[model samples]
Target chain A: MMAKSQTHSDGDLGDLLRVRDGFVLADVDTRSTPGYGQTKSDAQDDLAAGAEEFDELQERLYAQSRENPDSPAVLLVLQAMDTAGKGGIVRHVIGATDPQGIHLKAFKKPTPEELEHDFLWRIEREVPRAGYIGVFDRSHYEDVLIGRVRSLATPDEIERRYDAINDFERRITDAGVHLVKVMLHISKDEQRERLAERLERPDKHWKFNPGDIDERQLWDDYMGAYQVVLDRTSTPHAPWHVVPADRKWYARLAVQALLLDVLERIDPQWPVASFDVEAEKERLAAS
Target chain B: MMAKSQTHSDGDLGDLLRVRDGFVLADVDTRSTPGYGQTKSDAQDDLAAGAEEFDELQERLYAQSRENPDSPAVLLVLQAMDTAGKGGIVRHVIGATDPQGIHLKAFKKPTPEELEHDFLWRIEREVPRAGYIGVFDRSHYEDVLIGRVRSLATPDEIERRYDAINDFERRITDAGVHLVKVMLHISKDEQRERLAERLERPDKHWKFNPGDIDERQLWDDYMGAYQVVLDRTSTPHAPWHVVPADRKWYARLAVQALLLDVLERIDPQWPVASFDVEAEKERLAAS
Candidate 1:
């Protein structure tokens, strides 16, 4: 009887693994989704090629705003588990951007002052102005991830937050803020390799916390928590793109594609000059 | 008398150029100073090499902290003219540092809210916690530069700010924050070239504001302002390193060197546990 129960558990695990892998493949190919890149490839080399194209697209999007003073603002939220490569994606995809046009805010464990306010208050303060891009590294998603994992909030309260975030994102989207959300997902085995690498590499050691292993032990809990996070918050206006983060470059490229798609959708145009430059030139010539 | 006056003016211009060139060189070299690295041939080369080395050093520093848990924090302050390479340096050098351990804050033209408080208030709020690095792009030196150049303060008032800034640096330094200040200097001709390049480059056209040229016309005044900024704020605790701006790579390398130098000074050691591993292992094995 015990052996039969063990077999049943193993079968359930295998099914989950298959489903996760399927999502990984689907994410790379689904270009029809709004704010997603159309070009899809599974090979590492193809992903890199796509990355190069995506980078050029991003530069052009930034250029669009520079040329046109009235482009709507863009806010990109990146939330993921540890070793999900948030900084790597930021540097690879967003590093070349004009610093004046991009703002990066990394939210750590909330400070005492931040805790005193609502979950979104600190994030609200860092929103990019119109015509600029704001990138959040581990943003307000923490409210759900940490709060739910620890049972810090009641079930009803958690449900309310899911709605609150949906409403919040929609309001920001309506108010000329283009919101793109990406959740970087990595397999448990991949996460183990990454954590081990951080432990072995002296330079990466500072980022390693033994506490992370404790969280790793709670892997099933986190997966369950993230499942809830994705299902509840993935709305039409600010749907979450679960990027496969095992390939760091691919994740970055995918993010860039989403950004470019949003900016291109805006179709920014240069502001009109109040006077004619040719007439002024002719006046000066006549004088 | 006219000949003597021309000679004096020429000497003044030469002194100004010498000081300006010194700043440009120091800014480039300082980036590499915090780590072991070679000086580059030109600004572009310096930035590339400096960036690579700075990234490596940041990783090393973090690794050291994780291993030892006692590494002193490194604080980098970037001060430069409007188009100086502050943003680029920031993107390249600190770009790879773990976002959790790195704090980046841009001090823009003071808002009304900022003006209500002391000049250092905003900065105080952004200082990194223990075991973290803080990078400030345009820091408190504006108190001396803008204050003196615009004559917004009386001579005594400017002098007081200098003293206050010195005190501020001393306090932070004494409290374990290693402060490295860099000033990026560009020639008037280089400024013209950069401004024109922005206008001519389709992608950079938006970065070009005609008002920037208006500020360029006050080149002499701004130089005087920087000279005062340097003289008044260059305390032994936080001496300013001026880097040449004509070569961006060289400036990046210089900055990297300054960072490595400070990190090497505070080589953090990982604390070892005093427990008997053999006994613990045996107990675990038996269990």
Candidate 2:
């Protein structure tokens, strides 16, 4: 699996980590940081350095959008099992910049208002503005994730959701919103240890829930649901990156690097000011 | 001014930088990095290190909100003249984190759709979701800034907007959006130099505008407009921080520090998971 990931360049971490056709989610190591050949501390330092540049590129995207409304925005959808560190990614990766440029939504149990509409209704409302970054902690995939695992939705409905999500993402990308879907993968043992730690810590008690055990009973079923999700919904326009998330620092760094790669590809520039500079300078000097 | 800023503890940069009653925007030097007695390089390093911690706290805020919808969001409204580096601040200060948690709006010329409604209709649509950071690049304040300088709105209407803005912000704060308004102030000489630099580079020519000079001719008028804006709308819920914009690094660091201070005060904690952890752990281990 590592060898397969190594075929891609280090710079294209997205390609290296992205799930392609006939990919096996189970084969990928949850502890591996493919394409990045650095120590944990070194990766941390790189992430810190890259953050400044990321800020610049994100700003350029924002500036271009201001000058041209058709400019593109980026959306990162994080899907993971409870305790897989989706929250950590949201904080460590996306939290580095000014809160002003981000749009974050953590999908919870559908409300009465939400159930009245299609599952995608709430998601459509939260897409990032042009040049902004939109993050979904858990997303429409939930309808398929827990829905399939818990049999909350019928098979036909789950299938329809997969199609709906693909179409919805395509429409978004066509309208200049780049989508990066990430699945944070952790092993059963790692999760057990994390859960035990949560139980041991008084401060972490709020973060633990007994319901998670009910979900754990269906781990294989949940994995099957995830496999189906990765297979059906990971389209070319909105490919899914299955990040090995046992190591939180590496996961955060990889996600950051992935976003940086996307922003660099977009290459948004500072929009040319549409006003007269020479005349303005002279007039200002005179004033 | 620097001495006054230094009188406060380092953690209280927000209060140090905030505009209060009888505050004079012009009296604040545009070159000083108040409440932060570090070199530009040191500040940059400090900002880099703090970026991770900032991301964590912001995530906690978002997490808390997810667990409790009534949790507050922070809104950073940036107002500045062209070439004052609002773009830089948005990128450097706000851009460092996950774009997922940010809601950024750069208000430009109102569209036919926008013109049909109240000036704030568009603004209301863009307010940050709960637990998110909302950033306005040239926000509703522009209604008064340009509206006053260009006389786009009648003087009576301008006065009415001042009142309207106050009411609107009061409502926003009342609804749990902690607003941190900032004005990036630059001098006439600095503006000339930046404009000239913009003209000298083809890559930057796109960022140069002739209309900015027309506005430059009314720099004093704009200053008076900003002063009035600060005086009328800088309420307790949403105070204005007039940051010195001559040094881009210093301004970015100061604004970031100011936001950090606000987030610290809000101090959002990670939400406790609302499930049975022990049962879940046992079920998982057995499985």
Candidate 3:
């Protein structure tokens, strides 16, 4: 199912995966840093307004999907580090979705039963049907991210899974499932701050895992793993959108934009009127 | 916290429960049904329009939550029998929501560790924060539903849980969490039809579980179990809506109406401008 599709020129993958020593090594300091290279002074204002406008468009698209039940489905996969705001993104970015049509599956550490099947079996069962949308909090990408970071998979095995993911995602898209994958990028400082907050707040305590600190220690290793994962798996069928998540608004805006763009591309229709009105009308006239 | 808030004067508990069971037990004949009565004609239309409307409103409510960072969170829980459309409703209803501010958690049979805690503990941790929405495909209600259905909990034990659930939900609401519960009701024949279709279709085979049919055989018992569950647990704070799932549209619409009503009540805000230039300028000129 692999498409010898053109490279990332049409998408944001190349720039998104730019990294060194794995930590998304970039000069992403928003406050003191100058604006995104080519954008204008009012880019922020424009971006915000554009996001809201896209939101309006999205509302309509969603309504259209419901009104016309035959519309193609939307599937979103979120892959991120522990404190990288996967939960935050789900809470904030897609917060406005209709609960009836949105399917969310969160893949945590696999259970013994889950381990019995091939890695993607659980996810395969959870894919949204046509005209629906599915969001994976942590997706099949785990095979690469955690596996590579932990060195659980051999180098050859990691490479093979990359090809496998490419094939799997291509089949889904070929079957008309529009896919969007996002990697929320947060700096070490931000991670530390959020981790502390999770620990400090009583209600947030449930979210804190001491294991996350251990993962944080391997930040560089994970970054190296993500760089290769991005390079190998970012395909035309399902490209990655790596948003700067330290600043929440920008992250939300980027995700919304990517969704709007893809959904509009595969704009689906509600089922056609089941009964033929003209035929019924003709029969009535003849009677 | 229990307000005998008797807002539901639409009908008597017994009558409504009877109506509920009547609707569930109503044969394939929608033409002349007891609970449906004359409500059938408009029921089809309402189902169609209602499902779409519910999805639209849910998306908007979720969006409002995201934009207004301080808005109270919304929790949507779906508890129902097999093939009752828990997965279907989640997909069709909330699919359009922005992924950032919405959290979707599906609870399966308990893991060993999860079984260790009180049923509510894991679910409590999964609730979305302020300015977010959370949807549970199965939830703490399992403590009552499955516990009662499987006869795992005695009648007295289940009775104590009613108050505990009320208190737990009340605490969530008091903490600024809005709760919405939907019970999707599908007739036995429709379920049989659906099961047959799943068996016939290759892609749908994964969804077909023989266990679902086993549960269906105990349909009447499940109905009585649900009635008790609904009666004991439906409080003024988090009243339960028994959605008619025979027509998918009606199921979606009723859910939408409830969601829109709740969100309108919440009325989340747009962020206050950091710099209100007009007001600042006016003050400066006056000075």
What is the C-alpha lDDT profile of model 2 across A127-236, one tens digit per residue?
A: 98897888899998999999988888788988899999999999999999999889999987788888788877755766666777678777888899999999998898
lDDT of 1 at A181: 85
Q: Quantify all predictions' global Cα lDDT against the true fold.
A: 0.64, 0.81, 0.63
Q: A1-287 in candidate 3: lDDT tens per residue?
A: 00000121234423443332334334455222112332333335544455454444444455455445445678888887787777656655555555544677888888889888878898899888766667899988998989888877688977788888899999988886888888777877788777767555543444555567778878888877777777777776677766677766556545656666676566433223334435433332332
* Model 2 TM-score, all chains together: 0.80
Using TM-score, give the best candidate's number: 2
lDDT tens string, model 1, A142-249?
888878888777877777888888888888888778888887777766777777676555445556665566667776788778777776777667777777677675
CAPRI grade, predicted model 2: acceptable
Top-scoring candidate (lDDT)? 2
Query: If you assessed candidate 3 against the hidden native complex, which CAPRI class would it receive?
Result: incorrect
How close is candidate 3 at the interface, in terms of C-alpha RMSD after superposing the true interface residues? 16.8
Q: In model 3 chain A, where is the ten-residue run with the lowest total lDDT? A: A1-10
Arranged by DockQ, best first: 2, 1, 3
What does DockQ come to for candidate 2? 0.36
Best candidate according to DockQ: 2
Candidate 1: misplaced stretches above 4 Å?
A1-70, A95-101, A196-206, A247-249, A267-287, B1-47, B63-70, B92-102, B131-133, B199-203, B267-287
The native-contact fractions of the candidates, in order shown, are 0.10, 0.53, 0.17
Second chain of candidate 3: TM-score?
0.75
Clashes of each: 47, 40, 49
